[model samples]
Target: MQNMLLFFLFILFMDGVSGADETESVMEGDSVTLHTNLTEIQNDDTILWMFGPEDSVVSQITRKAGLTSFFVTDKERFRGRLRVDQKTGSLTIRNTRFRHSGKYKLTVSREQTTIKIFNVTVFGVVGEMDEVKSVSVMEGDPVTLQTDAEIHSDDLIVWRFGDKGILLAKIDVETKEISLNDDDERFRDRLQLNQTGSLIIKKTKTENAGFYELQIRGRESSQRFLLFVTGE
Candidate 1:
């Protein structure tokens, strides 16, 4: 009887450990869903979602006497990006960013306290542009940063240059606004943003030979290109 008791205790311990923690990996600008495996929530049950090392409360839902009250954290990183399902107690995060990578805890309170922990890792994605394709152009020629993807109305495109990552230009598809950061006059009127979020540089110079980066909002990754401008 003592041996059987020990065996049962060991099984319970293992089950508790397995049920307490989980790990997930997702790319930046992607969405992730954490499920609670609950088909229905009773009025007496309470659910809470917390994040990070501090375990700051991100969301909470309490049901009592058939009345439900839902609350969400006011943190800017999670604002307008979190969704909770009342029935299943599942949490979904939209457009996940690097700041969102951390530990998440879900607690359900009722007759028995249940806890679920998730260790989430968010990876930055490299965009679809060809990294190895060295764009060669002669001085005073025009060079286009090619982007093959279709642009959405709500999309935003940003261009940066060099190891210092200096912002060159930004284009907002929805607002149809193009902002040029021509602090050094490197790309003045010579720069143009096409409808497809590509950058066109007219009158390319030898000083333009460097690395350029292109990032699009709602995209899972950014693209980098090496520009080579040779003298005619």
Candidate 2:
């Protein structure tokens, strides 16, 4: 009896793996919605959304006595970014990052657990033109890295410096918010992001002379700028 039960369980697991759906791609900083296709959730039903290969629970909805309550995991990467519809059990992830790319599984439970799988791919955004440009500036002069791409609400722009790729500033194009890395004091009060997703550094210094990289979400491309700072 023990050997027969093990074989049955193995068959069920293989069935679940074979039923997985095709892969879907979403640009970084955008949103992806997953649908359960159920018009109404029953009282005895439980719905769950899990991420990655580890199957970490991301969101859950439970219905009891006709009352539904939603719960999301305390995972740091998903904080304040997950939303679900109470009636449909659809899941929406907002402001997705590159690290969020992986397999997502949705489980529905009543008398038995039914599994549905989705593979999500998050693509990085780079510029459309030449990969790199050169900029020469003197101390105390402003320098701007220009890109002709239109900025969208769900897009994110990241600026990094040097070969080590130290983060300088990250801009959320939708919110028009700029978050400068506190660890890098060299750019304090000198960096600004324009409406066009261009980065403007107010005053250049010798220390700022290096290779800079700009990554824009949704474009799946990146641009590089080499800065040569001369003494004033």
Candidate 3:
């Protein structure tokens, strides 16, 4: 399916398509929208969103007299997590999971055929598995590293950054309060935490690409996240 899509798109745009929104990286349980870059869809135009490897359909959009209808194709696989923008034909996947990671093809057909491909990566939720999972994010995009475990009432969760293990944020579940350490000023005001013990880095910077550790104080378990930043 992937090969067929690539070959068909290559034939359609032999010269190439400009500025295809090609890559997106997100964490598990997050939402991502792939834009079609169109201000509006004409009545005669039909848009199809396909996911490959198998090249299965994700959703299709068509317009009638004055209204648009969206048909979600792989509903069982996506479990009703797909959405589309009526005007732009952009597709959004809510509460994304690892199985949602793949290449998506957007085909806009009207007077002519235009194709765009997007590569999406969904990082697994950090757990006590103690694995160094690789995460990718675009510069200036916010990325979150979330844990799968529920916050215990008495747990003190600590999030650390970089190889030096700089303190980033500490969360107190008992008090529902957080203490942030930005003495290095690198993260300054771009770091935050959620009640789920997730570390969110906003406006991601290239230097922020490194090992991130999540540990609960007094526990012997820890998990690491290796992040890579692109497009400075």
Candidate 4:
């Protein structure tokens, strides 16, 4: 009985000496990897890994006894995705998503001394733009442009028009780009940023038609436009 008490005391002492150094970064689909040095731990020491801002217990491994245990939180997001490798102090998270981004801490305790702290980063999936079609607009009419979103995020909108590719107008939101070719030469002046990623060409004419394109960047997306000009 006395030996058991002493052993418990020793565990506390060792744990107190070493605190986990954790690093966190957002990852796509709710996944992340935690890495740290465990070389100094004795073959007999039991190491435990955990999750959450409070460092709630998640799993444990005893190398000397060849024993292991996993105790995960009831959170639906975690489910079976949280894992720990008994042979090494490595944690892997699968099926990551935006909501999975958060602070996590790890603590390693040996029978004698505590050694290192690791801070890890998990990357969140950011939306991105991949491709779009080139277009040309006429001198006086309305132009509509369009593109596909590769990822999901708040929409960031920017338009490029005119021969010099001047900045037009933007409505920062998640609306998809449209394919519109302007038809007003006065588009050079009457150009108005519209709700449809559309360009209004007040009065239809010949010179207003030309190449127009869109440049959009969002939390997790990007796009470019190419407007083609022609006589209408």
| TM-scores of all predicted structures | 0.48, 0.48, 0.48, 0.40
Per-model lDDT: 0.77, 0.75, 0.79, 0.51
Model 4 Cα lDDT, one tens digit per residue, 1-232: 9999999987787555655344455445655677646543346666666543345566565555554544555567577787776557677778765334333445565645554433333333343212334444453555556645443346556666544665655655555443332443345455555554544545444333333445556443444443333333
> How much is 188 displaced in model 3, in angstroms?
53
Please write out the lDDT profile of model 3 over residues 9-115, one tens digit for every residue: 87876543434447787878899999998999888788989875345788899987877888886566697899899888999999997667656778888667777
Please report the TM-score between candidate 3 and the true structure. Answer: 0.48
TM-score of 2: 0.48
lDDT for 119 in candidate 3 is 72
Give the alpha carbon lDDT tens digit for every residue of 112-167 in model 2: 67787776655567542255565667778999988756667788988887657898
Best by lDDT: 3
Query: Candidate 2 — which pairs collide?
Result: 124-220, 125-220, 125-221, 126-220, 126-221, 126-222
Best candidate per TM-score, number? 2
> Residue 158 of candidate 2: its Cα lDDT?
88
By lDDT, the candidates rank as 3, 1, 2, 4
Off by over 4 Å in 4: 1-15, 18-22, 39-43, 69-74, 113-124, 128-232
